[model samples]
Target chain A: MFASRPVVHPMEVAAAPANPAQQQQPQGVLMKDLPGMPGTPSGLALRVTQFLLAAVSLAVMSSTSDFASVTAFCYLIAAAILQCVWSLSVAIVDIYALLVKRCLRNRRLVAFFAIGDLIACGVIFSGACAAAGITVLIAQDLLMCSENHCSSFQTAVSMAFMCSFSLAPSFVLNFWSTAFAYRVVAAG
Target chain B: MFASRPVVHPMEVAAAPANPAQQQQPQGVLMKDLPGMPGTPSGLALRVTQFLLAAVSLAVMSSTSDFASVTAFCYLIAAAILQCVWSLSVAIVDIYALLVKRCLRNRRLVAFFAIGDLIACGVIFSGACAAAGITVLIAQDLLMCSENHCSSFQTAVSMAFMCSFSLAPSFVLNFWSTAFAYRVVAAG
Candidate 1:
């Protein structure tokens, strides 16, 4: 489809006019647009989901360290760890924001979230695709799925994708808000 | 830092108020934000870069077809091909846009661009990381660097990253514009 008319969907709900925060709330809006804003329940939940997914992915893949048998496995570890740490830190920020009732939404903060989430999304996507590729090898060409830690590899790959998917909404949300902040600038 | 003030950067140049596209330009802005906005020098350049990079990545990786030894290699093919097709069609669109001077920007189109660019970026990232992981394995653990297609593998991985990098600016530009367009939605 070349050009479809605009429709108000779930994603656009954040930009709805009745959102009073929009008035004196650029910062708050940015914070709320975050997947894991500390003050917002929805955002925190998204962050938790990402953390849990990354952790699960790591646990499943690491269930058998045979990942070291391939560099992709090592990358899975790196991606999972990065997701974990990122989710954890954001979660902490959420808590801190909640405690202070402070808004974390601002152009710079949204930009930070956008960049961080995007990079992690990239890593997770790469890990998942690579692991999936290798998993296919173990199952088909290698015919080692039955004997080796193939199941673990599969599980890990699945979780890596799950982690990526989980992080996606936040990425989208942060970027959407950031775009708004970005458009308001006047250049020389 | 949770709350940093915004800093005007190069990316914001396109969105500056002085740009004629700002007024009666929401649709045009959306159109211009596209990577393949026909006739436009910058837009065409971005599309060409993406196409060339993807093609090069595929050519280098497919040189030996030893990649078939690993599923990750297969995935790389898939990613490369998708990129190739996507870029080609968009390139055609750029040509069309140039000829017609027609507006292709709209919420749905921008949304499509956001989702498509984001997904492709994810796939490219995944492909590169996976291949790189395997490349490391071949060079170090397998001690096959001197004998096998190590150089080829390295070249492919580099090209894949190069493709990814080339795609980044367009992706960022599209999202930035999408966010701007997105902000105009009616509030609740």
Candidate 2:
């Protein structure tokens, strides 16, 4: 009974359209997209921004010793450290590539980059999010004590938000470059 | 002074050795690698596990309404919804690909999957981290209240940790498939 309905391959379905113009689009995109290239100006800029964001996230969250009191806040600090290390390592490589006018051609290195970025991305998100939750409570009148504590909470939340903004671009850039690099390797 | 160093193009570097064996390995990997293919059995299982983890995370955290008072607990519920929605959507598509015995061959769709998975990963991590902070506060005697509250806090922290565990595999699987898909498209 199930065989009554014709099953088709996605490639066949796409090929059936027989539109030459349509077939050309993906290659065009593959050639034009720069987000996946490792040492392009924009890519380097993204790495730099990521490093700065991690620094900002760590710095702002740690502005008050009170953060040591909350486990989530502590988690954020640790995540920031991971993010910073990864970003710095990539940035150094990117600079080397630029100065030497050569690409990072190692497939293993690219794979490692992809894995590390993904993990750091996850770590930073968790840290910022946990801290955000705490800050939200403090913002919404959860803190019944000193105005000093309230101000500190407000400052920390802003830092978390900043961290989130930084992470978004870094994630996009990393995913794009990793895909692009793999595609290049596959095609070669 | 910079001109003292020789500059060479990346393509030229790759072309220089002209190793026939090296040329063949990428395509072999392209054909054999399952990580980059969607709708495979392992891919589907990863999604299902993610959905279940999110469910467990929410259910355990919400065993008592007391969590509602804490903003991080509320955030965890919201993050779980995001995780579930993304997981279910991908699973449905994966099922279709399996039933038809065809790949999800669209480049745009694969890109969308990568972006969505990354975002959800970030969201869930954040929620788990936030709730983690609060639970630690309670466990460390920072709460200064009822013993029942302390017990509930312990339970929720354990659940968040489980959520973290589940998220790791899903992220890895998503990254692998997305990279593979892009490589296929680029090669084509």
Candidate 3:
């Protein structure tokens, strides 16, 4: 009885054309077509913005003579540097993809982007929160916010927050795109 | 000329049995069969461990007489509380799945787990880092580490770190499983 039916490999099944519904709609579009997705113009813009914000954050914090004296501020500097490097590299990739008009929706590439963004999110979040914690202490007069470059520190921390905020959508979209690409090959 | 071939649906193509290579391999297994994956015994064990660690972290931190005195410590407390609640709830779900011998590989469930885990990771990581920053300052004698349950606070921070570490594998597994389950539905 089974032999009467055509043998269908699962891999081929992923691209099968029998279902009219499947044929009518595009497949594997979990927000991949969004403007901010990787390889798109908006993606490049977002990456550039992230890079600029992180760079400005690091630069602003470093300008303060006494930032190094606090462990939280130092951590923020490290996080900002990481964010800057990551965003710049990805922006370069985005620009290249745009120039060539190539799709950056490959599973491996999406996975890489997702993981990198996740790490960046965690690191920057911690740095920003820690800096904010210390800033609160300073504000409460527990320490000397007035004797040092407190305003600059605050500005740098806010920049980090902005950079992280921009990263949030990218992170979710890439993760969703990756999930949509999961057409696993069948086993014998 | 185009009508010569059979019309196949993409959904069926995902499960097609024609490809010998695909038939020889298991489909949709991005580490989903591992013990630590959801709906498995090891997954339950990991969740229990996470819950215990987070609970202990919160308990220890709150035990200190002056933890509320510092904003960083207060943040740590909040993070620990969030972790405890999240892990405990998931552990209950894991247990129920195990009791019924049911698979928890549904797309929505996996997505929920992934997002929750990501948020927990960020929160706890920031909390731990902030607490550690304060600890460093105290150790350097910039603050009074010798007074008001300093050692207890340190222990609590360590517990939070451990809880986050335990969550790392679960986070990766759930994300992978969610990706593997991403078979887009055919449109009507």
Candidate 4:
């Protein structure tokens, strides 16, 4: 009976096996029987959805502000650039893990990714807090001293700091979720 | 032989069994033997660390802002209030979940809590993004229109929105983790 079934390797198992019993098998078994696809459709769909939501959210946020000012535009450009770098770095790290099959270990890589991601989140969060703080301070100054008395240079510096602070949490959370997803994928 | 062994209920199990053989038992078996107790000391430490880190991160971010006017103080206060609310809400929800043993069965309450948590994460994310966006806009306006002409009112609004947006994912993650921990406690 065992011989007739053939000695199939674990990796061939399909992600969504035809039989639920088969689906419960280990990853190696699934990988062996299943085709070696570069990426799973479900994973791709999830990534696309996350990207779309992020884009929409960012767009909505940007729409609320006047982008025509050079200072504002420069800040926006810098933020955009930073975001790109942060996201790409995460993706690259994930890909590297996947390629190496280190993802299978459920090991320290998850923690490493988590730490890196959190640092990024911390940066973003810090930026936001600083911006909000500065905004409040500037508004307070204006209310107290009149618009002419408010220091523009000081205010600008404050805004930059606030924006950076606010974004810090985001990077942390992103790292956390990515690590979580990686664990799930590896387990599956 | 089975009957000879003491019929300890699942809820009586505290932490992992000392026996290596029993430690490897299925989660269901482990849960049946141990009722909930204070989680491992390490887990508690981790939670405390996370809270402190988050607080420090927020503080650092606030310090960076220029706060030229009294209005800036208003924004800062608002941001602080929101953060406090968000954090407290999470703690409250966690406590409630623990007390009620909501982690056991799949129920409407769990779903409701999950949704609420997701919304919170969204709020956090949105706030952060908006703060960054507003900073850029303010900088631009300052450079183009002069110090007196530039205002970050719109950016402030955006920060509020972004703050709301960022809270969702974290909420979901926390809820699930707590639920899992509950199961672990119940099973042991």
The TM-scores of all predictions, comma-separated, are: 0.77, 0.68, 0.78, 0.36
State each model's CA lDDT, in order: 0.72, 0.65, 0.78, 0.40
Model 2: residue B152 alpha-carbon error in angstroms: 4.0
CA shift at A160, candidate 2, in angstroms?
Answer: 4.2
lDDT of 3 by residue, B18-115 (tens): 66564554444223465687788899899889888888888988888877778889889899889988988888888898899888877578779988
lDDT for each residue of candidate 4 in B1-188, tens digit (9 for 90 to 100): 13342323333344333455544655422222112211223222333333443354355444544533344333433454555565565455546556665442232343454555554444444444444444454554444335522244334444444444444334444444444434344434
Q: By lDDT, rank the candidates, best first.
A: 3, 1, 2, 4
lDDT of 1 by residue, B7-83 (tens): 22323443343455544444433443444433466777887898898899899888885677787787887899999
**Distance from true position, residue B102, model 1, in Å?**
4.2
Separate DockQ for every predicted complex: 0.28, 0.24, 0.34, 0.14
Worst 10 residues of 1 chain A by lDDT: A1-10
- RMSD (CA, Å), candidate 4 to true, equals 12.8
What lDDT tens digits, residue by residue, belong to model 2 across residues B10-104? 34544454566645554423333354346777878777887787777677767776777877788888888778787888888889989998766
Runs of candidate 2 exceeding 4 Å displacement: A1-38, A100-102, A164-176, A179-188, B1-38, B89-106, B141-154, B164-175
Interface RMSD (Å), each candidate?
15.9, 16.5, 7.2, 14.6
Q: Report, for candidate 3, the interface RMSD.
A: 7.2
lDDT of 3 by residue, A50-117 (tens): 99999999999999998877888899999999998999899999999999988787767887999899
What are the runs in model 1 whose C-alpha is more than 4 Å off? Answer: A1-38, A185-188, B1-39, B100-103, B185-188
